[model samples]
Target: MKKVGSFVGDWWRLVSPYFRSEEWPYAIPLLIGAIALTLGSVGLEVLFNDWSRRFYDALEKKDEAAFWREIMTFSWLAALFIAAAVTRYIVSPYLRLRWRRWLTGRYLAHWLDSRGYYRIELERTIDNADQRIAEDLRQLGEYTMQLLLGFISAVATLISFLFILWQLSGPLSLKFIGIDVEIPGYMAIAALLYAIVGTFLANVVGRRLISLNFMKQRYEANFRFGLVRVRENSEGIALYGGEQREMDMLNLRFADVFRNGWRVLFTEAQLTLYQAGYAQMAIIFPYLVTAPRFFAGAITLGVMMQTASAFGQVYTALSFFVNNYTAVAELRAVMDRLQGLQEASDKKPATAIAVEPQPGGRDIAVEAMTLALPHGQTLLADTTLVLSRGTSTLISGTSGSGKSTLFRALAGIWPFGSGRVHVPAGARVLFLPQKPYIPIGTLRDAVKYPDEHSAASDGEIVAALETARLGHLAGRLDEDTHWTNILSGGEQQRLAIARALVFKPDWLFLDEATASLDEVNEAAVYDALKRQLPGTTLVSIGHRPSLRQWHDRRLELQRTPGEAGRLVEGAAPA
Candidate 1:
């Protein structure tokens, strides 16, 4: 019971967003329309159940005219039913799409907001975010819609049909050896009782199926993520002769999936045995209960048939949980995943960058500060620093000595420890990482990313490329291709520099932005920056000591074993 309550709670949390969002106007109406149509369908079913009795009576009495009239009445009811069913069909898909759209947008916003994506990546968060967003969201919508409509229909049918069956069935007063055994509406009571017992037993036997299904989704996602990882890094793996290892690893994940899948299959088979048996028995149980009354001549054949139909409706209503057990289980899994992601995203507070505007205007400051990782491991400590305007500062240190980490702290992304990062308000800055991000678009859009494609002029873009010693790339700016895959590492780096030159940021920070380029090419890009934006401040992380000569100041993180890296002061006016 507690487990069931937990599942409902989680499901509500997952689903409430759509009804409360911008899509609610349309979503609510479509949902209400679908529900109304569902109720109408149920009403038609009850009417048809009532018709069954009259038709059967006409048959028993050999009344041809009466039978034909009943047939035509049934045809009219069938048309109404078709109309209701069609309305439900039309409204349901619209609601599903709108709900899915709202949910997808909400999840995307939460996942990407305020460097939450980066934090999740660093923390090795719940595996297969891609699957959660793509596959699970799709299933969540489809299954929820089906279950909701199915349940509503079941309830409506049960309530509407039960009264008619009661009148048709009359009463049951059985005497076993002269003792009274009074069962009122015996057929309906028996169907309800039978469904309750069956559903209860099914749940007891299939409780483990929930866990099995959850693990199956996880295993499938893990196996798929492994295969995708291999595909994405196939080139690197082949170069290092690691295909065998990757294949072995991928096979291991697949084996986990196979193992978990077996558990689900076995559990579901056990459930299927009970459910199929219960459903088959349902067809006859009504007739058995009403047979006595029929034999006694208390009711006609039509009443017997009507009793059977009503019994089926009651059984369906009571067994709603049983029939949809698998979907419920799957919904539980999706809820768990989405909730985890939501909690993780919400936990990361927005870290405000402490960029205090200075007297000299736009000078960056890190005053008596420290930066630690989310795990409480300090990356940089006791750092009192200032980067005045127009000064080219180079950050040099051994790899993993907190050079790039400090840059991240400065960028207001590494939200770990206490400190203020001060920069002048309204000052624009850009951080170019080791490997530049080449978006899937025209070279112009890739270069002018974070800004609209329409923001930068073609001549200005070409001029920036020419300045960065990537003049050859200028002619291809109009062409669209996967630039990251096609361009050499050095060329990509040069392209990033060209982007900086075009945007002319107030402060440009590059972490190993020139590592892939030859010394001459690196010098050419650096020379381009000096010539294009001599007044722009540059803070760069690089291991090549030869490049330090271009900077006016330096900051190095001194590393020690078992101790956090500390930023020490250095000379200026290089």
Candidate 2:
């Protein structure tokens, strides 16, 4: 019971938000209408059950006129049922679609906001968030509607038919131990017991399916991610001739998928075997239990048939859980994944460096900042630094000395740290990594990325590209393509520099951003920054000796064995 309550709470957490959202006006009405249709369908089934009794009795009595009359009656009931089903077909899917759209929007907003996506990746807290947002939300929306409506309909059917079955069943009188025993509503009792037993067995046989489905989703996502990685890194793979290695890795991922899939298939088959046998037996079990009354002429033909139909309805209603155990298991897995992602995204680190903005300030300051790796190893201890406006500073360090991590700390995305970083309020800051991110869009958009809505005119973009030595791409500003795949490494770097030029941020931090370019092009790009954005402070992380000449001050991260590195102001290496 406690577990059931917790599961309901988790489901409500995922479901109730949509109906309570801004779309509630539309969402609520559709939901109510769907429930109404489901109940109406159940009502139709009850009418059909009564009609079956009348029609069969008419045939038994050879009353042709009454038979035709019941046929006409059945025609109307069938029409209503068909109309209800058609309406449901339309209303249900549209409702699911609207709900999914709203949910997708909300998840996307949360995942993208405050760099939650990056932090999730950095901490390795959740896997395949894209799958959660895309596929799992889809399944949640569809299955919620399906199972909710189905359960409601089942309850309605049970209530409407249980009384009819009880009255039709009459009483079973038996002599036990020289005492007369009369059991009332014997057929209803039989159905209840039978369904209880079936449900228990179904659960016992399929209990492993929930975890299996969970692992199946993960394995499928991992395999798909592997394929996407191969496509994204196709060039590198080809350069190193690692096709066979990639194939082997992909085969390993798929082996998990195959092994888990076989387990799911075998388990489902066992459940299906029990359900199929249960249903087939249910077809004749009603007659078997009620046969003595009919044979003894205690009940009419119509009463016997009515008893059977009512028994079927009551039993089906009681067996809802047995029939839907597989779907329930799948939904549980989806809920677990989505809840995990929400929890992970909402979590905050115990100790994080504070990044505050200083209004009307002219410099950026990192005060006694302690940066660490995700594993709790201190990278930079008690590091204090300041970057004055209109100056260029080059930060150099040995490999793995936390230069890039410090850059992340300044950017306010690093969570494994403590202290404070104060940036000038309303200051525009840009950090260009070694491999620039070229969104799959127009050339102009790629250059104006991280600020897609910037009002930089095409002329300015062309000028920026020309300044960054990517003048060759200036003419193709409007061409939309996979800019990352089409652009060479050096060209992508130049495009990033073009972005820096266009945005003209108050501060620019480049972590080996120009490493792909030759010395001449690198120098040209740096000189252009000096000439075009003299007021912008330039902070760079690179080991090239040639880079020192571009900056006014050089800071190196000096480290000792078993101690965190510290930034030391030093002369540029000659």
Candidate 3:
């Protein structure tokens, strides 16, 4: 009972949001419509139960005309029952689609808003986001529709049928050890009690399934994520001959899935043994209980048949929870995941980046800045620096010396820092990481991205591409497709250069953005920057010795293995 209470409370927490959301007007009406259809369906069920009595009685009495009449009556009643059922499910898919759209949009907004998604990745362990959005939302939408409608119908069936069953049962004579006690309508009470017991036991045995299924989903997603990562990095792993290691790691992840799946199958099989057998026995239990009285002619055959049908309805209604244990538990787990994700995505801003826009000066300054890792390990200390507007600089450092981490700090993404950076108003700062993001869309949107699709005309976009020496891609501006897989690393970097030119930002930070390109391509891209964006400030972090001549100022990070990171000086180009 306590466990059941907990689940009910949690389910309400998860379910109440949708009904109260901005879409509630449409949702509420459809919900009420579905519930009404369910109630009508149950009512038809009751009428059909009553019809079974007369029809069976007519058969037993060998009354041909009456039998035909009863059959015709049952046919119409069945038709009405089916129509009600249809209404209940007719709008079900539409409702599911709408609800999913609302929920997915909500998640997306929350995840992307205010750097919440980035913080969640840094600070929390909520993985399988794709699965959460796609699989969980799909299941939640469909299950809520099916389960809520079923609950309504079950409640109505219980109320309507329980009354008919009590009245029809009249009196049930209890017998044990040759002793007999007669009680009014006691058979209805017996069936109710039996159903309640079965429901309780089923819950006790199946309650752990919620956590199990939750873990199962996680493991499956992890396995799939492993495969996706492999597919994405196939070239690198193959180059390093790491296929065997990758296979072993993937197997370990999937092993969790296999073991948990076996456990579920084992337990589910046992549950089916009892639940299926219990339900099957119910079909005959009613007839058997009333058989003696039926034989003794305590009532007509019609009453007997009606008593059996009513008993069936009462039991089925009472056993609803037992039947839906899996779905209910799985839904609860999904709710927990979504709630956790919402919390993770909405995490509070860590100590704010002490960076500001300079009022009249065209310069970037860092004063008494301290950079730390997420766990409070100081990576850089007492760093004060200034880069005037229109000055080109290069940041150089050894392997794993917190150079990239410093870039993150300067960009205001690495929040484990205390510093002030001021850029003049209207100065757009663009950071191009080694792995530039290529959004799936027309080439124009990818190039002029984070900009509206209509912001740049085709001529301007093509001209910008030509300036970046990516004239080959200029013709594909209007084609909507995934360019990430199609473009080579060198071409992608060239396109990144196009983005810098098209946006015409005041400051551009290139974090090894030209690493994959040949010297000719790299020098060509740099020349394009000089020609097209002469007044823009350029700061780059790279390891290539050949990149030294492109900048006028240099900064570096040096770290001994297992020691803290520190700033060091490097050569500055004239």
Give each prediction's root-mean-square deviation over alpha carbons. Answer: 2.1, 1.4, 2.4
For model 3, give the RMSD to the true fold: 2.4
lDDT value for model 2: 0.91
Query: Candidate 1 local accuracy as lDDT?
Result: 0.81
TM-score head-to-head 1 vs 2, winner: 2
TM-score, every prediction? 0.95, 0.98, 0.93
After superposing candidate 2, which stretches have Cα over 4 Å from the reference?
Answer: 176-179, 572-574
lDDT of each: 0.81, 0.91, 0.83
| Tens digits of lDDT, candidate 1, 1-574 | 7977887777787888788887778988888888888888787787788788889999999999999999899889988988877877778998888787878888888888877777787777677777788878888899888888898888887777667666666667767568688767766677678878988898888888767777887899889888878876767898899988998998899999999888888888988998999899999888887798789898788878878888888888889999888888888777777787788776764433354555446688888677776666776666788887877888788877878778787887876666787787778799999988899889998889876744678899998888777888878877888787788888898889988987888999999999998898888888878887876788888878778778888877788755777766667634
Best candidate, lDDT-wise? 2
Model 1 stretches with alpha carbons more than 4 Å out: 349-360, 571-574
Error of 2 at 275 (Å): 1.1
Per residue, candidate 2 scores C-alpha lDDT tens digits across 178-280 of: 6599999988888999999999999899989999999999999999999999999999999999999999999999999999999999999999999999999
| Clashes per candidate, residues 3 or more apart or on different chains | 6, 0, 2
Q: TM-score-based ranking, best first?
A: 2, 1, 3
lDDT of 3 by residue, 199-281 (tens): 98998788888888898889999999999999988888998999999999999999999999998887787778879988998
